[model samples]
Target chain A: MTGSAAAALQVEGLWKSFGPLDVLQGIDLEVAEHEVIALIGASGSGKSTLLRCINLLETIDEGRIFIEGEEITAKGVNVDRIRRRVGIVFQSFNLFPHMRVIDNVTLGPRKVLKRPASDAEADAMRLLERFGLAEKAGQLPDRLSGGQQQRVAIVRALAMQPDLLLLDEVTSALDPELVAEVLNVIRELAAGGMTMLIATHEMGFARDIANRVCFLDAGRILEQGPPAQIFAEPREARTRQFLTRIIEAGRL
Target chain B: MTAQGGPDATSRGGPASLPGSRAQRRRDERTSALRSTLVAFLSTFVVFGVLVYIVVNSPGWPAVQASFFAPDIFWSSLPGIVAAFLVNIQLFLISEVLILALALVLAVARSSTAPVLFPVRLMATVYVDIFRALPGVLVIYILGFGIPGLNLPGVPTDPFLYAIVALTLIYSAYVSEVYRAGIASIHPSQTAAARSLGLSQPQALRYVVLPQAIRRVVPPLLNDFIGLQKDTVLVSYIGVVEIFRQSQIVEAGTFNFTPYLATALVFLVVTIPLARFTDWLVARQARRGGGASGAASQVASALGRSRGGQAAP
Candidate 1:
């Protein structure tokens, strides 16, 4: 579903603050169409906040976010329109617990897109199948495993056919064994040319899948470069210390 | 001391010589038997008390027996009974339908953060509080008699219509609280997920929040419906010829209270099934792990097992 050869998202001079706490300070990032970018940061470093801002889930204090050249931060812009083209998967899976997996996946398409039930069902089934959740089509979210639910959440977003996908620690809520399954589905999505911006702590998945990696700290982009440069040789002392602590904690 | 030592020695000699121990054992057994007998007797007494109360307090038992074969009184009261039944059903059904619709709107309006919604929120709060605080009798009386000067053109300000309107208004307030609680019980993440899927606020609420909220509120809603059913009797005060009112008229004419007993039986017959259905719904929700009781535990266990399995390898 790759469209024109243009940037899928461009976030420039994004400034956001929650009261006195500066969550994002003049951050800039870009992702080409079909490119995957990993945003890595410690908790409270504003990675998730940045992702939320891109999808307009969180209103930025200042800055402009554009998806497919449509400025999302413009006054009087229909946020719902922008959100339609940008899918987001939360860290908590956040599947509608009352709905069946199939229903959860097709809700947006059927309700927002106003598609027929049968057509939405078919598309939902296809997406569920892609995520290895076809068998769980009739199961409620709470009945599914955390990984299965997260994968279903992904399919739920994918059924919207977004131009850009924002993943805010999508696999963080899953069990370690299940995390790999969700990440594997995401890897497949990236390989299939889905444009993705992921905020994650899974360094191996980031290293393997991300075309570019950015390190964020205290609401600022500490560094941005290729994964090899960011992971293999760090130039900043803060980056080295952060990597050392993460490595010592056995999370890397 | 010698004698006591002798007895202790004898008791310690063998199990056969354990006099105090045997006696103590017999006493313990007798006490337990007495306790069991007392409990059984108390339960039987309670049951007998209820049956006796029914038999003694029930009016015109002999009259009912004498007229049992005649069917005259029963036949005479049939029309009133049928009318009351129909009105009761209409009142309940209309009130329930209106309550459900209004409750959902009120719930959404109350939950919204828009500045314009503030007045709506206040209005909903005031409506709920006022109706909930007022007795049903007062509400029916006010609607039936107090609103005399105001009448819609060509529409009769009849007691029946007044009763229906009053009941709908009162029940809608109570039902809205149920809806609000159900909607609030849902995790905020669900709304976030819907929004992230690009659903407009209305789309998300209609497709996502409302369905879940309605499902959770089903048992409570059923309870409210039963309450509404019973509250139909209050309309009798306004001369609507409901079951209670019909019974009163029959009693006045016949100088016999059999009709009142019959009315009570009718109420029992109608409300018992509704109560049982509510119970069944509650149990169904419980088994589905959707109710308040074990839902958290079940979710916790599921999450724990999944985490354990993942951690294993």
Candidate 2:
């Protein structure tokens, strides 16, 4: 546990573009060990793109991503090794529909980590129980509700015991009633000191649960600070406008 | 009041008995008669054409009874028919296994972004294009004779083996397209999810994408198998002793065409079940809400319904 003092993730001047469109333009951020950082942005603001780059799903055009203080941008960085240290969840649950819940959870550990099947399943079941999804272990993802499927996805990632978890609007696809269930799971994770960077639209969750809140606009980080300061005392006009629009929509 | 109502009843009955009503009824009868006459004319034309064809090309009733219905010819050709049947089953089994395995590799390779994947993409494109564009007869010939000195040792250079390999190659190309479409049809989010779980590219494909792709592609794969079953008859050209080739031999020896008709019957007997099975699979896929091709839309609709259902609860 003493090693937890190191920064869980560090990003510096990350730049990504697809042809003419610049998605993440010179973004810099760092996630401390066991800290929850909420990334708030409008559509096409590159918040999701930034999360993907952090996990190396979308290769950055130029930047350095370091995990445990080791730079991962250089050639021959063994990307798979870096990926093992980070886990991500999508807006859509993206559960493997053909696989049973437990198999979905254990696949990475069994295949990537080379753990024995028995050990993988044991760990998977423990994570499933933590997410309150133990009863649905034998069922395929299609058989579960959206909220339950998202939770299973979280458990699937957690089964890897990743050092950092990236959640990109994990509850965006769920029903209004189901959103609370998934958020509760995330809240529980945060409470247990799991380092997380969540790109979310749930203003209340972002404001209350995140240790630090970062506002993204047009592929750049516009403002970032502790949630109490960022939400209650906005520094930039753009940040103020963004928060006001979200608050108005939440009331509707 | 009852006396006043009696006049209203009389007026109502008068409308049904009027001369204008009778005229309208006659017009309706004439229209119905004309419609029936037109339908009868079309039906009679179809039935008459079929009857005339049968009468003209009957091959003589006495000859048919003697050649087909007689026990001698039917029983004598049993061995040949059984041999052909066995070869057909073997051809399908071998070709299907090879095609499925190859198609998976081809599909995945084509989907990858690596520079090495270019050759795989090119090969898949070329293979599918050549086989699909060229006739099956041409493919069978190329495999049979085009590969100079390409005989397996101790295997006698059998045409049946050549035919099986040819069919496998041609069908593998077609099946690869089905697989590509199936794999492409999956929501990209699935791969993203697997990657997010720390799976390598190959691992994600092997454990996640391929399974879903195969499930969606099964019906079409069966359809391709049915097509392969029929095309096996084309192997008769290389003297493979398939059902059609055996029928040709029997026809030449007996100087009767009954064997050719018997070959047709045999083909129908084998392929009808396969076609029906494909139909059943398609119907089952349809019942799963018009197949898995529209997976994104299906997911969205399912999410919408769940949201609505939850609201009521």
Candidate 3:
């Protein structure tokens, strides 16, 4: 395949499996620089696994993933280095439960990047302040609300200034009232031209922020296009059924 | 809760309990109180108090008192017992530090997944299983006497050093299990998050996992340490004159046993504080995790008052 300057991430014939289960099958995607790509799927359609494969968190059974023209799946690709560049935030907001919020955000910078404590903390504080969480700097993750914790997870990833961000259903675990706080953070990141691949169940947020949407079904991309087309004029019947359920549930 | 323990509906203390009828509540409380009193009386006074009375009032009482509880002998022997106790304390302190360091290393190695650490993990696991099954006193006897008996070139035969080494090896096996439990108890997501941020496996364990694991296991680790403290008397069997040894020597020479009783009292004096400290730590952790707010709220209120006291100039 030709290298495209506009593409920040490119996946070629990606496949993943877990023993007897085929989770991601023949997934090919190209995310242009500064683009927000939202993956919309039913519960077991391999959306999250696809994002994980891109970050090399879940190893692929076959195929390759390229980040900014460099193949991350090749042998001796330095997985930790690739993981540093493509940071991921889980739905559970897996913050280091023992550390204070500022410490959690600064840990990566200080340990991996070998930044001085003072410099790392300054960077962490800047990210926290941007997310309106400056007062919680000294508090542990359990002390914060679900939404606040999710936002802190984002700040932790952003502290590294990664080339790409993989957000896995980041707001799915939050209460309805708390979901906006987390979604607003993502909106601001998208507005600031952060290249993010998000797997989400929030159809409205997908429409609002995503430049493109991929609708996955049973381990394959059934339909994908600009969010306007995928949401309003889905080409596949499975996509239509998913949107209809979301609409009836008053979530669309 | 107390006032609502009445049995009849109209006879209940007040609106405090609107669910259970007063008659039922009173019956429950009465039965509970009766069972509690019966247990307290049987377990405490009848079983223990009666035995003590029989022993104290027996015809052999005077001879036993002369042998074991003669106050004059206890007072006279105190200086020697006190001197010997200092040796036990020194052994305990030295072995405690060494055991903690060795246990932490074993725990980390046991928990590692890297193929390079496979043999170390197997060795640590096998070591813990074997030594935990081996009787601690037997370990002391074999090493305590065997090392000195060997009398190898360049090897020290000091009983103090042997005692310390034997205790460390035995206790490290137990303490390492506590550390491993602590490390395993930490959720895997913590490591996932750390590694996602680019920390290597060791870096992840050091910066994120161990601090939490160590904090959680402090109470249990202290329990093991206190066991080590009590086990110091076993060193006397190896010919180091700790408190038990000094007390026994006095008993043999003077034909009185008060020094032995004094040694028992001293052991209690040391052990009780450690037991209490461990209880406090476990309770503090529970309160911090928001369990048992009855105790936790009291702490919070006390803390509030202290801060207010400071702010009042």
Specify the highest-DockQ model's number. Answer: 3
Q: Give the per-residue Cα lDDT of candidate 3 at A141.
A: 71
lDDT of 1: 0.81
- Report RMSD for candidate 2: 8.0
Which 10-residue span in candidate 2 chain B carries the lowest summed lDDT?
B304-313
**Model 2 segments more than 4 A misplaced:** A1-5, B1-83, B146-155, B290-313
Positional deviation of residue A176's Cα in model 3 after best superposition, in angstroms:
1.4
Top TM-score model:
3
Q: On a 0 to 1 TM-score scale, where does candidate 1 land against the true structure?
A: 0.80
Better of 1 and 3 by TM-score: 3
Q: By the TM-score metric, which is better: model 1 or model 2?
A: 2
* Candidate 1 chain A weakest lDDT stretch, 10 residues: A1-10
Score each candidate by Cα lDDT: 0.81, 0.80, 0.86
B203-300, model 1: which lDDT tens digit per residue?
A: 77787777677666777888988888889889988888778887788878877666665666677898999899778767655786664323432433
Candidate DockQ scores, in order: 0.22, 0.24, 0.44
Write the residue-wise lDDT of candidate 2 on A128-162 in tens digits: 88788888887767778999989998998888889
Docking class of 1: incorrect
Candidate 2 local Cα displacement, residue B269, angstroms:
1.6
